[model samples]
Target: MEPESGVNGTAIAEFILLGLVESPGLQPVVFVVFFVAYLVTVGGNLSILAAILVEPKLHTPMYFFLGNLSVLDVGCISVTIPSMLGRLVSHKRTVPYGACLTQLFFFHQLAGVDCFLLTAMAYDRFLAICRPLTYSACMNHTVQRMLVAVSWVCAFTNALTHTVAISTLNFCGPNVINHFYCDLPQLFQLSCSNIQLNELLLFGLGVLMAGAPVILIVTSYTHVAIAVLRIRSAEGRKKAFSTCGSHLTVVGIFYGTDVFSYMRLGSVEASDKDKGIGILNTVISPMLNPLIYSLRNPDVQCALRRVLTRKQAMV
Candidate 1:
C-alpha cells in the first residue's frame, strides 16, 4: 500500500508481526512446540467440555462453569495461535487493520468472560463448602445462565469500547507490532495519536475486568480457608481444599502473566519479555487449566473414563 497525498511516509494499511522467534533457525522448533501446545489445549478443554455434557452425574454448578471456561480457552487460543503459527513459518506476516480490530475485540471479550467465570467458579466453591445447605437453591441453572449472560454483556461492551477506540488512532508509520498477536498495549506503542485517554480507559477497565475479580477470589478463598480449618475431620478438609486447588493454580498463572503484561510499560527490551509472557498466557496456561482441574477431580476422571470407554466400546 502506497502513501496517500500529504500523508507522512505511507499511510499504514497493515502491521507486521514480529513473532516470538526472530532467528530463522529457531522458527521451526518454536513453531512445533507451540503447535503441539495448541493441540493439547484444544484437546484437553474439549475433553472436559464433552465429559460435562455427556455425563448426567457430573452436571453441577462447578462443571457448568468449567465447561464455559474450557470453551473460552479454546476461543482464546484459536484467535491468536493461528496467526502466531503462520508468522513463525511465513515471511509475509502483515495483518490488516480490520483483522487486528477483530482479533483485539474477541481476545479481550473472552478475557473478560474468563475473569468473570473464574470469579463465579470461585464463588461456586465458596458456596459448596461454606453454604452447603443452600448451594443448590442459590445457584440453580437459571442463576448460572444469568451470571454468564451478564458476563458476556459486560465483556462485549468492554471489548467494543477498546476496539472502537483503537480504530480512531492514527498510525503514520513504523507499523511493525512487537508481539505475535495484535494486543492493545502493542498497538498503543505504534500510535502517533495521544493515548492518555486510551491508557485511562485500559486502567479503568483493568480494575473491572481483572482487579475486582482478584479481590473477590481472595475474599472468597479467605472464608474458605477459615471454614476448612474449622472442619473436624482431616479427610473432609482435604476434599474441600482439593476442589479449589486447581482453580487457584490456574488463577495464579493467568493473573500473574496478565498483571505483568498490562502493568508494565512497553519498550525495546520489554517486547521480548512480553512475548514470553504472551506464550504463557496463550499457550501454556490454557493447556494447564483443564489438566489441573481433571487431575485433581475424581468425578471428572470417572466421567472421562466413562466417555472414553463408551467411545471404545462403540468403535
Candidate 2:
C-alpha cells in the first residue's frame, strides 16, 4: 500500500486503537470490569503511598522503594488502562498520534523504573540479609536516594530511545493497532517503513532493561538464600525471608509477565494471547501489589487504620 503517514506530506493524523476486547456485545461488560479494576488499582496504590508517607515506622530504605514502586504501579496502569477502557465502549477508538506516543513513552519509562527499583530493593535485601552489620552503612539515606534517582534516570533514558525510534516510523493505511494499548510490537506491525533496525533496537534494549535486572535480582537473592540458610535458628530463617518475600513475589509477577510479553521478537505480530498476558502485568499486578506488600505488613495495616480513623473523626 502507498504511504499514508510517512516522511511524505500525506502524514495520517491519528491511529485507531482496536482494543483487545472487540465484541460489541461484551464491550459493556468488559468496560465495567476494567473500569472497576482501574479504580481499585489507583486507590490501592494511593493507600500504600499514604501509609508509607505517614508511618514513621516505615521510614526506611525498603519502604522508601516500595513507595516508589507503588507510585510507578499507579502510573503504569493509569497510562494505558484509561485509554483501553475508553476503547471498550466508544464507537471511535481513536487516539491522536501525539497522545498515543505520549502514552507509549510513559508506559516504557514507568515500567523501566519498576524493573530497576525492584532490582535495587533486591540489593537492599541482600545487604540486610548477608551483611547485617554493614547494611546500614551500605544502604544509607544517600545511597537509597541515589538508587532511586538512578532508576528514574536510566528508565527515562531507555524510554527516550524507544519513543524516538517509534516516532520516526511511517504508518500507511490500516493505521490500527490490535492490542489494547500502543505497545511497541503492535506499533511495529503498523509501520510501513523498514523495521529491521527498530527490531534490533527492541531486542537489544529489551535485554538490557529486562534481562539485566533479572540477573541482578537473581544474584542478589542467591546470596540472600545462602545467608538465610546459614542462620541456624528457624526463626532467623523465617525473619530473613519475610523481609524480601513480598519484593520477590512482586518481582516474579512483574518480570514474568513483562519479559514474556515484550521480549518476543518485534517482527512477530502481537496476538490476542499477548494482550491477555498484558492484563496480568498492567492491571492485575498493580492491583495486587498493594495488597500483597502492605496488608501483610503490620506497620502498613496499623498506619492505614490510623489514617482511616483520623479521616472518619474529621468528617
Candidate 3:
C-alpha cells in the first residue's frame, strides 16, 4: 500500500523503522530478550513504588523522591520498548508519522523528567547528609511535591518545544528512520527543509533539559562527599555513603549512555552501535534502577520482605 500524502504535498504519512537487526533469524532472539527486560523493568519499578506507598517507615522525603523516580523509569521504558517489540515480530515494520511524533514527544519528556528527578533526589541526599538539622524542614511533604511537579512541568515544556519545531518541517521523499525509534536527530536528517532552527533548539534545550540537572546532581554529591568525610566514626561514614551510593550509580549509568548518544550529534547517520546504546539507555537502565536500589539498601529490602510476608500470611 502506498503512503498517503500529507497536507504539505510532499510529506509521507508513514515511515519505515529499520530496526536494530536486519536478519530474520535474529528477530525472535531479540524479541524474547527485550520482552523479558521489559517485564522485569515494569514489575520491579512497580514493586518499589508499591513498597514505598505501603510502608509507613518509608514516608520520608527520600522515599517520596525514589517513588517518583520509579514511576518515571517505568514511563520512560514503556514509551519505546512496546513499539520496538511490535516492530520486531511484524514483517512490515512501519510507523505512522503522527505516531512517530508522539513517541518522540513522550520519550524525550519522560527522559527529561528522569533527569530532573535524579537531581531532586541528589539534593534530598545532600540536605540529609550536609545539613542534617535542616533536612526535614527543607524537604517537607509540600516541598517534595512541589519539586516533583516542577520537574514534570519543565520536562513537558521541553518536549513540546521540540515536537512543535519538528512538526513544522517538511519530509519530501525518504521516509525510512534508521534506528529502532523516532529520535530527533534521525528525523532532522530526513527533513527536506532547512533544520537550522530545529538544530539550534535541539542543542540549546537539550543542554538545559539534561546538562543542568547533571550539574546539580554532581554538585550535590560533592557536598555530600565532604560531609561524609567529616564523620569521625567509620560506621557513620559507611552508613552515609551507602545512602547516597545507589543514587550515584543510577545517575552515572543514565548520564553516561545519554552523553554518548546525544553529544555526538554532528554525525547525521545512525549506526548499529547507536541502537545498542539506545537499548542500554532505554531498556537496561530502567531494569537496573530497581535492582540497584533494592539490593544496595537494606531498608528497602526489609520493607519488601515485610510486604511479601504479610501477603503470604493472608493467602
Residue-wise lDDT of candidate 2 within 1-315, one digit each (tens)? 222443642275787877866778888888888999999999989888898888999898889998999999999899988878766656678988888888889999999999899999999888888888998999999999999999999999999999888888877757777777887888877777787898899889888898999999999999999889989999878877876788888888988898777667644566888888878978999999998887567888998888788779999
Whole-model lDDT per candidate: 0.87, 0.85, 0.87
- Model 1: per-residue Cα lDDT at residue 268: 32
Ranking of all candidate structures by their TM-score, best first? 3, 1, 2
lDDT of 3 by residue, 1-315 (tens): 233357553367888998878889999998999899999899999889888988888888889989988998899899998989987867778998889989999998999988888999999999998998988899888999899999889999999999888888888869888788898878878888888888889889878988888889889999989989999999999988888888899999999998888777688777787898989988999999988888978779888888778779999
lDDT of 1 at 121: 93
Please give the distance, in angstroms, between residue 201's alpha carbon in candidate 3 and its true position after superposition.
0.7
In order of listing, the candidates' clash counts read 0, 0, 0
Give the residue spans of candidate 2 off by over 4 A.
1-10, 266-268
Worst 10 residues of 1 by lDDT: 1-10
TM-score of predicted structure 2: 0.93
Descending-lDDT candidate ranking: 1, 3, 2
